[model samples]
Structures are given as structure tokens and as C-alpha cells.
Target: MTQDDMPRTVRTLLRELDRASLATILPAEPAGWPYASLVLVAVDHDLSPILLLSDMAEHTKAIKADGRVSLLFDGTGGLDQPLTGPRATVLGRAERIADDRLKARFLARHPDAALYAGFKDFAFYRLTVDRAHLVGGFGKIRWIEAAELVPPQAEGLAEAEAAIVEHMNADHADAIQLYATKLIGRAGDGWTMTGIDPEGIDLRRGGEVARLAFDEPLRAAGEARKALVALVGRARALP
Candidate 1:
């Protein structure tokens, strides 16, 4: 869908789905491909799927031979209709992964899988997507490019992100107060900044909200640190 034609909630849901764990449909062993096992998948910053599997999984062996796969995941929830929930499906080519770095990222996001992470029988695979179908709702469907749906990487982003959350949740609890009272042009009751990204910071004010973006990119580690400090200061200075 064109950026203008896409709804804001739909866009947000797409991003969230990109970050969520995916389930790959693996063929069952010793039988018809009718049975599919659900496997947890990690998506790289580029929106490629990462799979950790056991040698015992019939699907893993099937992937080694065919190198083709499909993934499915739940999308955003519906407001008007319960049955019309959002969902997504991705078609891709799979490859076995032996890289330690990629494996680390996959494991980090799914630490709970450590129980089987180290078994010699387990392996990791990466999926290069060919196309994706995103269903925002019953009538809202769109095709998405893997690149357009991927997340961005900013240097020192993790540290900057954590610091922003800490400062906002700690010192400037009242500046959030001003966001609710003045910037939003509403009464002061409850407000806070919950998350930050390369684009901007997400603010929660009472039941209302806003997204504040930076005029320029925060490139280096030093720059990100300075930008976050300035952001906290700006919030604190608000009336």
C-alpha cells in the first residue's frame, strides 16, 4: 500500500509484526506434508527470518533439500470485528546459518530457547523473503516489500534508547506533565515518554499521545548520548 493510503494503526501494527517472532510451516516426517510444525522465527533488521531448529525436526531436513519455506504470524487486533483479525504470510528461500554472530542475535531475542540452543542436533537457518502479504483487517490488505517493512539501525542505539527510558521514567515525570497540559493542549493529569527510535520518541499523555522526531539524525555514540540528554532537558523545561 502507498504510504498515504495506509492507516497509521496499520503501519504501527506492521512494524510490531516485523519485530515479533514468526512461525514457519514445516513438513511432517514419514508422512504427507499435511502436518506442519510451528517453529519460532527471528527476523533480522532486514526482515529476513531466522530459524533455530533441531535435526530431529522433519521440517529442518525438508528445508535443507527444498530450501523453500512459508511463515505466518498474527497481525494487529480488530476494533469492530473480532473474527476479522489481522495476519501476515511471508514466502522466502531458506539457507542454513553457521555464522556465530547471527546466531547470537537470534538467541538474544529468544533467550528462553537456551534449553535447546546448544544441542549438537540443533541448527539455525535464515530465510530471504521473496514476498509478503499483510492483512490489516478483513478489507484492508496490502503487499509489502521486505526492505520497506524492515527496521533501521542507528549507532549506539541500544544505550541511547535505554537511557531515554530511564531519564523520562525517573526525573522528568512532570515534564510529561507539560506534554499533557500544554503541548497536547489538554489538562495535566498523566503523561510519559515510553520509547525512542531513530525517527523520534513516543509519548504517552493520560489517554492521549504524540510522536516527537528529531530534526537531524543522531549518528555516533557521542551524538546519540548528547541527543538523549537534550531530549530529557527539553522535556524537563516544559511548563
Candidate 2:
């Protein structure tokens, strides 16, 4: 399948992003009209988007009253070349997630959130993707099923995220550098593996974040190990 036709490509774009335009129903509006706002976002293990919303924000209040929401992620190269890139709008319900594990994961991607993360007025909310609309440039547009955007996570994988990250960071740092520099075309030596899920692995180097998708989705640690090894082998052969 072409890149535009592949569901994994859509997921990878979303997973690699950190921001999106969030649209919510304005509760007090006569027509329950939509109100859009910019939100800092992170990807959860389940492939859903995580947001830290302040209770005082109109969008957050609207979300509490009505759970329905949508997030727009545009990979448009720039406003100067608007129609030449891809954009995806995720449709779902927003639900507050108080789990510390999730909060920590979100914080790893967005350390600035720590300033207000402990405040009573701010809380983490996850968008439960129900469907999506993707426009890949001019002629490539499709309504994607939620299953295509938010695929199933591996059993027992969530519990192993810490171990996986620790092992990669502590024992295989060089492999990460090669993966980032060679396979991802990133030039850096300080890259660290932050998170890995069924969809892909997340890498961070200084301020930049990179995502490395598996050739196929994996179900457990063994699969992750093999996939990672293969990726390193491929990266080694690139030169």
C-alpha cells in the first residue's frame, strides 16, 4: 500500500506530534457550537492523545459537560505551502485520567507540564479516538476508522515500559544513537529512548523528539527486542 493509504503512517504522524488544535462543544452556546484552541499533547500507550487541561479553560469546562471532542494535527510543511502536506482530525470523547503512570508518561514528553501538573485546577485527559478524517495533500483524503487510528495495545506491555526504557538507555545507548542518526536521519549522540508501545518507539534528544515505527506492530517484549535488533541491523547497513 502507498504511504497515504497505510493506517500505520497516520498513527505514526500522530504519535510523533506534540501539539494539536483541540475542538470542543461550547456548552453555553445556543447551538452547542465548536470552539477550537491550541493544546499541548502527548501520545498515550493506547495510541490516544493525552492533554493537560485547566479546569478554568472554556474548552476544558465544555469537555467536562460534553465529552465529545476533536483534535486537528496538520503536518503541512508551512502556511506558504499549505496544501502540499497532510492533516488529520481525530474524533473522540475526552476523559480525565488520574493514573500516576499515565501522568508520568505524559510528563516525560512534556516536562513543562510539571509546573502546573500538581495544581488542583489542572488535570490530564485522554481522547478516546472514535474515528478520524485524514487529508493527505490534495487528492488523498479518507475517513479512517478509529481502529485504524487507535490500535490495540499488547497484553502486559504497559507494565514493561519502564524496564524497556531503562534497558535501552542504560545498556544500549549506542544503539539508540545509531537508530536516531542512521535510520531516522537525526544527527545527535544524546538520544534517549523514552517510551515504546505496540505502535512504535519514542526517542528524545535535547528538545527534539523522534519516533521509530516497527515494520509491524509488536505484542510483547520479545517482539520488541527482535524489532529493535533488526532496526539496528538495518541502520548499520545504511552506509
Candidate 3:
């Protein structure tokens, strides 16, 4: 597949795989040849895999000895059928950090792992991605370069994000209801706009629902706020 097709496949892979197995190729021992072990990991904001390992763990020792590692994320693990979704492999070098800030970020998303987070033996390691191979279904496969795969921080995003949340929660209640009834085909009481960027806006309507993103780029905070107001007015005006 062409480079143009990689972004979509990578996005799909990201959405599909919540957990991955990281394999560290150990150095040759007295027995000769290396070995591989699987560890459950969470993906960070930068798409790097976060591993919580104890110093006593054999894999951790191996990784320290040789930083080279590969992570496998297979979406078909839970399915009974073979090759139901996509599978991806990420190649990178792992680095261990004792930074509290970085650890907090990782723990926020993987709260269940808190039990092990404070363990004296457990340390956090992040794999800095060098290359990726994404197989998006049977005939679709592509090699993704690190530069092209990661999303750059959106410019002028802070004010726009704040405005979106305020407008959606305050005056766009009915519009959010309409979004639920028309788009999601459900009845929603209230909505919340969590984050917004150049690509789209993320919204939550009633309960802890699925995230929704708008296709068209919202020009500015004021424009987006006005657009949402207009949308509600139109929805309420309709028969």
C-alpha cells in the first residue's frame, strides 16, 4: 500500500488495540540464542507502549541488557474467528524513566494498574517507536514511518477547546439531544465537549457514551460556538 493509506490504517490499529504484548529479545545466555517474553502494556499519548515491570522480572533484566524490542498488538485475540480485524507490530528501543510526571500521565489512563505502580520493584518503561507495520484487514498492509504516523499538536487549540465545552454544556443542550436522536439514534439528556483540535471535536452525550468527532474543521472558537447554537435552533425549529 502507498504511504497515503498508512495513516487511516494506523488510526484503526490504535482504536482497536487497547492492550499489547511487548517482546524483549534477550542476549544469548550460556545455553546460546536469545528468548522472547510477552508483557501486557498500555499505549501512551505518543503511541509508545507503557510497560510496568519489576526489577526481578526476567524480561526487565533482558531489556536492560539489550534495549531492542518489538510490540505486537493483535485485535483478533478475543474473537473466535481468525484475522477478523487488524494486527500491528511496532519496533523500537525501550527506556526506563523515574520521572513522576510521566508516570502520572500513564497511570491516569491505566488506573487498574495502580496496584503495581507503587511497588518498589515495579518501574515504568516506554518504547520509543522507530518503525511500524500495520495490516488493516487481508489485502491492506503498509509500513508506517514514525514521522508520518504521529499527530502533531494542534495550533491555537486551548481557547477553542475551552469555548467548545462551555457552549456545548450551556446553550446547546437541545442540539446535543438532537445529535443523540438523529445521529446516534438514542435519547440523551445532556452533553459534554471534552477536547477539540484541527481534526475534530470530541463530545460526550449522556452517560459515558462513545466519543464523537466533527468532520469539518471548526474555524475558530467563536465560529464553533455560533455553529452549535445555530444547530440547536434549527433542530428545535424542525417538525
Candidate 4:
């Protein structure tokens, strides 16, 4: 990946990963220590990380006291030299939110969590990104401002995403499978699109997930439709 590809790589890591290490400041007596915990994550259309936490959780308590937090999305799994792989550290403030859309997005990415999502103590939080530090590889490190990393909101795309995902999963199952196998070269069945954004489409088949990025970023629902059609065509032509 070139330097120009760093933003895309960062978004891919954030979107594709199911879990991340969430670091929050300790609120106790011997305070100021960093507390890291495993957390499931999902991203909004603007790439903001969304999380679901119980009020009793340590991280949630810390956020109530001080919203500042960091999330590490490690993309180095299976690498013989872990440091040679790409990883990102997102610095942000986590504030509890009541948006139903965000909550649904988080649950869509982590369907198993739906069981407890309705409990009174569980609430959703969105990290307002300040910036991100990315290590693409040895000589490919950089600090990316939030503006540089996240694209401007694509008009109507966020609202249209769920319907688009439903249409593909319900009506175009074969094309979805072709995307996983023929396009991205993964051997699979039952691959369904969980989300779509200006950057790419997110696919899931059981526990495994995949990210299929577009050749170029799109700006609206119509453009996304064109891109998806074009992608399957390319996949079909590949021998």
C-alpha cells in the first residue's frame, strides 16, 4: 500500500475488525493508570467507533469520569512479525449516546450481543475521533487528522445503507456469494452484506468477515448501486 492508501487501510481495519483493545484512564485511588479491555466495536458511516458497554463495566465508569480514551485495532493476526503488520490507535472522547441507529449498527456487527443489549445497564457510546496514529509498516507511519481520515458524509448513504444491505441479502444472495468467492477469492457460501459505506461493503459468512473496497470512493446511494453492479461484473469476468 502506498502512502495515499493509508486512510483506506485505516478505515478497512476499523470496519473489518470485530473487536479491539479499549484503553481508558483508571478512575480509582491509584488513578491515572491505563486500563485496557477487550471490546466489540462497530463504525458509523463517518468511521467513528461505536461501542456497547454496561454501566457496571470499569471502562464505562472511567468514561463517565473522563471521556478520553484510545482504541487499538490490531491487524497483525497470523503475521510472523507482528510489528510488520498494520495497526491503528484512535484517540477520542467516548460519550454515551441514545441514537437507535448506532445501537442497531453495533448489534448488526455483533448479533450475539443482542441478547443483553436491552438490559437497563447497557448503553451505546460513540467515540468522537480527535485523530489517529497509523503504522502501516516500518517506514509507513503517520498521524492522520480526523478530517483527513474520514470522508465527508455522503448524502443519504447512511440512511440508505440498511435497506440496500437488506435488498442484497434478501434478493441477490448469489451475487453476494460471488463477491466473496469469485471476486475476493474466498471459498464460502452464505456470505451476506452487513453494511455498506462510501468506502466499501462489509460481508459476513458465519464468524468470518470480509471487506471489499471500491476502486474509488462513492458519494451517494445511486453511485453505490453502480459500483456494486460493476464489481460483480468484474468478478464474473475473472477466469
Q: Largest TM-score belongs to which candidate?
A: 4
**What ranking of all candidate models by TM-score puts the best one first?**
4, 2, 3, 1
Clash count in backbone of candidate 3: 0
Please provide, for model 4 over 1-239, each residue's C-alpha lDDT reduced to its tens digit, 9 standing for 90 to 100: 78778887888899879889999999996588899999999999999999999999999999999999999999999899998999999999999999988887787777788999999999999999999999987898998888878764568888888889889999999889989998888886788888888888888887887888889888777898899999989989988
Cand. 4 TM to true fold: 0.95
What's the lDDT for all of these models?
0.60, 0.84, 0.62, 0.89
TM-scores for every candidate against the unseen true structure: 0.58, 0.88, 0.63, 0.95
The candidate with the higher lDDT, 3 or 4, is: 4
Candidate 1, superposed: residue stretches over 4 Å from native: 1-35, 76-80, 150-239
Query: Residue by residue across 140-200, what tens digits does model 3's lDDT show?
Result: 7777888876753444544355555556657766666675565545565665554444444
Q: Which wins on lDDT, candidate 2 or candidate 3?
A: 2
RMSD per candidate (Å) reads 7.2, 2.4, 6.0, 1.4
Off by over 4 Å in 3: 1-3, 28-36, 77-81, 155-239
- lDDT of residue 157 for candidate 4: 89
Question: Candidate 2's residue-wise lDDT over 1-239, tens digit each?
Answer: 36546566568678888789999999885548889999988887777898999999999989989999999987774468798688888899999988877887788777777999999999999888898888877777888887666665777777778788889999999999998999899986799987888878898887788888888878776678888899999999998
- Model 1 clash number: 0
Model 3, position 222: C-alpha lDDT score: 46
Measured by lDDT, the strongest candidate is 4
lDDT of 2: 0.84
Residue clash pairs of candidate 4: none
Could you tell which candidate, 3 or 4, scores higher by TM-score?
A: 4
Clashes of 2: 0
